[model samples]
Target chain A: MKLLSIKFTNIEEEWKYEKIELFDLTLLVGVSGVGKTQILKSIHTLKEIAGGQSVNGIKWELEFQTLKGNKYLWLGEFETINSANELNPEFFIELGDLKEPKIISEQIFLNDKIIIDRNSEKFQFNGNEMPKLNSTESAIHILKEEHLIKDIYENFNLIILRDHTFKIVDLFDLNQYRIEKLKNQFKTFEEIKKSDLNTFHKLVLIYDVSKSAFEEIKSRFIEVFPQVENIRVAHNVINEHSNFDLETSLIQIKEKNVQKWIPHHKMSSGMFRTLLHTAEMYLWNEGTVILIDEFENGLGLNCIDVLTEDLIYENNKIQFIATSHHPYIINKIPYDYWKIVTRKGGIIKAFDAKDFDLGKSHHDRFMNLINHPFYKQGIS
Target chain B: MNLYFILKGEKTEVLLYPKWINYIIPHYKQVFLEKDVIENNFYIFSGGGIPSIYNHTINAIKNINDNPVFDKLIVCLDGEDIGIEERLQEIKKHIENSKVVLNPKCKIEFVIQNICIETWFLGNRKIVKKVPEGLMLREFIAHYNVNTNDPEELKKI
Candidate 1:
């Protein structure tokens, strides 16, 4: 599903995000504490709610186009209720009463026609009243079996959130038992090719399946780090002291003028991040919405250019909603993709770079943007 | 000698400086690429304006330190409301706080235009007509004839 726009509000937190229009590539540019990351988190929250998780005090209106070319508008609110009211208030208060959040109201529209109309008490699906449904879960999840709602529910799986602050654990560092299980899973090349694996695993699998595809990824990686002469994924005997050797798949890079190949664990964080991003761009399924918070985090100056170029030129079908404070990343990306976020108290708003008449002049757009009152003052 | 410029006005100065530099210093060719700097080459970078220019100056200092090939680092900015001395102090303060020391080999220079660079344009009597067509321009010229008086003393009006 391709997101067109979104409006999110958290009553408890007193935070509200105004309707922010989206594009194929939306770079959320803002000062810190303006709720740029919160916008991404809100989308992820909707995905979680659609997947049957109950979250409190959130009201969201999301407009997206499905893979089948159907435009869907999903709006809903979840209210938190004090559990103490249902039981003995005094007794429950002493035990630290839990607050149960339930769906208060929800409506789904397909091309302006309402598919589901719901309230706290009851709901109507396709103009027909349905039996009593659970208030804690979304109709999209509960009625996932229904033909109209099934695709919408499944589309939530396409929304992927990536936070680069945390280091991605090396696959080789996994416990021996888990590594053995992965080894067993990868025994059949055909199975490995067909199975749904993470980007790193898929990076290794791509090498076994298609050399040309692997070469494409390696060449892209080399563009960022020219020192890397070669990159390969192979089964390395990590532990060979005992009678039975513990083998695990490893991605190793051979650098120029370096005799030994550097394994994944030995690779710098920047190098590994660049390689993983390259693999993700090449390998992720089409129509996926990858929300990357802090796109430049842990990335070196060299990696920023190639990765930004790849993100803009490559992944034509995939959508990227990334946030960044780095000037290099901002300048590298054309102003057409920028969504300058601003905030006043709890209300956050995002304005397109075009709205401010940026990039129209001959001067550097990044310089112009930074000088503008909207960017410097964080309000328009 | 490789010259590096960090200008204030994002549009006018950035567009005009290269032409002025090329005309004034014919031997020093303009290098479009940052890494391709050789002898007798120059590069121009815009720093937006005012406060933003301070950070840009700091960044340029860092760049100059890293690439010692640059023989001169010239910063051209509008004095604006702060005047030349105040603007120089602001830039110096930012550089000092950033702790990005410039290469000792490279000579540093500042060209602070009083009021703005546009005021200097008025100083050229050939460009400023004796009887200006626009009422605002005519009144401005009548009050303070830039051709006669020093344009640097022009106030904010």
Candidate 2:
């Protein structure tokens, strides 16, 4: 599933519902304190909720489409009670666009059929009347109880949202869990090779070492660091005690000499960041949504070029939403992919860069619009 | 010819230079290839104020000499209570005493606006009559153009 657009309000007292349309590669750029990071954080929170966390008191109207060419529009409104931790959510889901959008009604549909309808205190689902649901819980929270809408619920679960975190200090500090996952994938490949069920096994190939994703990531990493000769998963022998196993597959770099392979911790900040980004970009499962705040944290101009190009043309399977403050990155990206954010009276707002009609040469026009705010600030 | 300019005023110079620069400096060949207004080949750098204009001019000359992109360096500044000859001599001495050598092929010229940049606008009798006395002409200069090249017309006001 791909998120097409979103409209949200009541965030930090911003009275208007700001709508942001996303593309394959969407980037948010603005001055500091303009709520660029806050937008990413809100999306990350929603993604976590979609992954089964209790929904919070943040109102949002979202539209997404599945791979099977089905569109779903959902509006969610949540209210906070006496305690800060408590939430009261009301959801409205529609299968497709209708002539009159039911803005003030609680409705849920599956394939153009009404599955759930809640009016004030009365609740009905699939023509059967049910007891009044708790005001503080979402209707989706009790989807298992019905059991009739299993396929629809499973389709909703397919929406994967992943937040990629980056910190300068932890750039090279390899996560143990990621290393173990890689080793397990390799072990799975070995197990499949040893099996002799030729008829069923020929139908599918679970994992092939030659087609390992690590090789592709290595090529991308080398593009950023041409001096990097090779990159591979190796075991770090500290005084010759431990062996190459699941807990640690240290990313080793061979630069000038094949004999001297520098481990992950020994890599520079720029090198480590480029390698980690390359690995994460290719490793994420297809159709996954990723949110990255300040994507060009430690990258140089050339590295940013490679990354933005990859985001624009290379990675179609994964959808990206990133925030950046660099003009070099902003100018290179197509203007249609930009969401220019701004703040006023402590309230933040965002609008698509294309809305300003920045002529054909978007880079020059974008700069002209941003530098002279009086010309475009009235857009919101 | 390739050229770099250093202007020592605020919006008055920034706004007026783009429209009037081609007529002000004669060293650049007037190659108005298109009828529509297009960006000039010359580069303009703001020197902040009168004093900084002198320092910025020298730095720009040295920078062009090091990289050798421009063939000429034109620095424009305001007389600002001092005579035009004194400011010219001050720049001449610095160019002669500099350890970093200037590019021999590159020629440097200094253009001093009498009193200040605003006085150039006041030089025009038509503009002086339109705005009230003692009012800043910064906003008025936004409509500046290349109409006349008469130095005597500019000197009368």
Candidate 3:
């Protein structure tokens, strides 16, 4: 479920909801505390809201649609699709475009009709105080006209964290337990094969990984990363009780030729971040959206530009969304993918490239903010 | 034609990013010299501001997050293919202005051309020695090795 776009309507210090295009790798750039990270976090929040879940922080109007048609648009009339068949297909949660967009303000709508009218706290059909869900009913089911959206709403996983924890959070913890669940859900016999990163391969293939093939993949990893000198694989070693998915170690290669074993932590922070980026890119090659905060934390200034080029340009397959303090990252990621936000008077304002002067690139805009205080500091 | 031949050593070789180094945005003043020459420069950082032709310069050049002045770029080392490619890169970027006079038997004795680019990058041409020219540096090193460590080695040649 790739995020197609986002819009903010009626938020303070900014205009009403407007469309902002997202690229394969989208960068959120603005002055410090100007709400750049907030834009990414809001995407997380909007996904939750569409699924009809609870969330904190500044509320926003949200609208989304799944690649599949919106069969979950209407609540009461949902069964008609099942009876008549194939009425609604696309499912999306356009935070600002949905029928019951959760804005702090009272009224919400789809196109024109009020989905959530403040005066009418409850939806028009219920005509009572807002129907608080019993931890089951999704707002996605409640607001739209179609009913099949429940599947789309149920599919997403929301990740919310402060700056330091982003790397650990985004990775899917395919521990031991989750693997059992998959087996219980659908049984199949696939021999457990060697090494870490290959677990992703083993489950996908359900076969043995030969010694030669193992080295082949390692060599591929080495082409991009020269630091890795050794590699090995261990299969079928999974925790029986954990909610663990298929987990293997594409871990540090320990070759008999090399006596010293250097743990990944021993590497420089910049190098560490690069490894994490590479691992994530390896997993989420396509639709999975990757969100990172402080992408340039420990990298050298020169490495920042090169790394940015590698991800936003070279590996343009997955959806990459990150917040960065380093200006050079902006120089490489592109001008349009950035969404500039400013915080003023306890309210955050979202601004796109069009809102500002045309000629200035996102990097130049960022440097401009650095020169001007009103745009620099981020919310700690 | 501007050419820059970095008398590269271990200190500079470590800074290369493997493949072709098409261009470098000038951010530090870099120089190249042989390895094993350690001294205290006005440079507060151990390797800071020391002139060297080597790979170890990666960490030192990176120390400039605090102080940056675009003075030098790309010192190289000659280690097998990696070393050779790095040296070739140096020749490619700094083949002009440095006035390189080569005595070799190769169609491509030396070249330093100014290619147009949108960004500010180092413009260097390489005195890419054909097989014969590369062979010459090898033979010259051996020729000088007889008294290579001595200052008077060139007089014997």
Candidate 4:
């Protein structure tokens, strides 16, 4: 299932024509705070809702097309009663509206069939009467409770908004983890192994030389870092207790120096960050969407080029939407991939580089255009 | 569609070329790719000064030849120290030696700011009267009206 497009207003404004059309790999480029991360977070809200988490004040209109040629549309309106009450006391006092977030209107359709449609009080599932749903609960979540609507709910969800399909790797968050881990080896490998493997660990596992499948990855790492002759990953038993109940496996890495294996906590921060980020590229199983913010956080110029080129030309499965403030990151990618987001009169506008005849040597020109004082002004 | 201008100086030359273009052709908006691409479909880039500009422009053309986003090319420089014709010939010779083949249909043009873009600005009587005589073009733009609303109007004087 792939997301075809997403249409939503960020701050309670009615969405008239604002929509982001997504390709297999879409890139969002702009200065800081032009709603790039906000756009990403809005998409993440769908995943949260899918996980039974409620989202408030999200005016969303999303469309998805499956590999099987089925199309699904989810139209939802979330209203925050408290803000309304505070600003307009007369309206909320007369209605006695609750201060929490509630679904004002919700609709989900598969092709032309109305799977679920909810008004303020009652909702219909496949044209059948559903129980009186709380305004706060999503129609998908509420419908999931009914056995009759369970299949429909699951189908709609799996095809359109599977939680696993969406992944956001914010390097800033990873940096915090790296900083804590660097200062103190508080967590053992057993903890990381027991915990759900994040993209970082999933990537690091590729170099777990214990696995025969990772030989290619090991060689690639060697090519990049010649100083490292070989890398070995293992879960060492650092602590043990009676009945093996307290045995802990610490993730350890040994370099080619023929010395004692060191904990991953002791490894260089740059290498750890680099390996974690790039290792995801070697894994063949493509995610539905991968959102990377600050893609150039720890990567060198050469590494950035490799990753950028790979994402732009080679990968076909994962739909990638990345944000970058680095000029090199923005310049390396082709102009057609650029979504020059700018704000004017407090409205964010995204201009597709393909829409403009940005000259034959646009990459060179683009480098200059972005630095121009009026670059923040929406496309003329 | 994309245009490149390899100027032989710093900000003074950078700011002056656009003013000169506006002075010559007022409606032709200076579209830097770093900003927005206007409807006229022209882009201008200044790749530093002197040998850097020469090498950078050549490499940029070659890179474009490999990828080819820019169909039209323009290389501009000041004929301050070097002879304008000699500089153009040297650039042409360098391009001929390289692997790049300029598109036959591409409108490739070369312009030299005679004595430099500063000369044109200092040509204005108002500028000459306002400033001490015999200051460099860079000094003239720098000393007075550095952030003028009408940069091109300096040419009228």
* Per-residue accuracy of model 3 over A1-380 as CA lDDT, tens digit each: 45555655323223223455566666776656666665776677555555555332233434433335231222111111121223433254344543332323333333344444432134433233555433223345454444433445443432223254344322333554344444444333223321222224333333222344445555554555565676443334456777643554333445345686544444455654554444444333233456777777777765565567667665644567787766568756666676665665455655564455433221144433333323434332
Query: Which regions in candidate 1 have their CA more than 4 angstroms from the true location?
Result: A81-96, A173-196, A236-247, A358-362, B1-157
Write candidate 4's Cα lDDT for A1-380 as tens digits. 56778877645442222678876766777767677766666777775664456565667788876545577788887774436434665444644553557788889888867888888877888887767767677776766766644543454343221122222223222333442342243244333333334544543444332254456655665666666666555433223443432222233455676577765456555555445445545553433466677777767775676678778876676667777777677778776777767665446666676786544442354555553544544433
Error of 3 at B12 (Å): 36
Runs in model 2 deviating more than 4 A are A11-16, A82-114, A118-120, A131-135, A144-212, A236-246, A257-259, A344-348, A360-363, A374-380, B1-157
Q: Judged by DockQ cut-offs, is candidate 3 incorrect, acceptable, medium or high?
A: incorrect
DockQ of 3: 0.02
TM-score of model number 1, chain B: 0.90
Tens digit per residue, CA lDDT, model 2, A1-380: 57787776543244433777778788887767677777766665554444345443366766666656566655555542233222522223232521211112245555566676665456677778888655444455556445654433444453433333434334222344343343354455444333332211211223234356556767777878888898766543232444533233456789975579887767776677666556556554455567777877778776788887878887787788888877678778887888778766545667777775533221143443443443235333
Q: Please, what are the lDDT tens digits per residue for candidate 2 over residues B25-74?
A: 64553221111112335666663475645665666665666556566677
Instruction: Score residue B77 of candidate 2 by CA lDDT.
Output: 75
- How many clashes does each candidate structure show, in the order listed? 0, 0, 98, 15
> How big is the positional error of residue A188 in model 4, measured in Å on the Cα after superposition?
23
TM per candidate comes to: 0.68, 0.58, 0.47, 0.64
Interface RMSD of 3: 16.0
Q: Model 4 RMSD to the real structure? A: 9.4
Model 4 local distance difference test score: 0.59
- Determine the backbone clash count of candidate 2: 0
lDDT of 2: 0.58
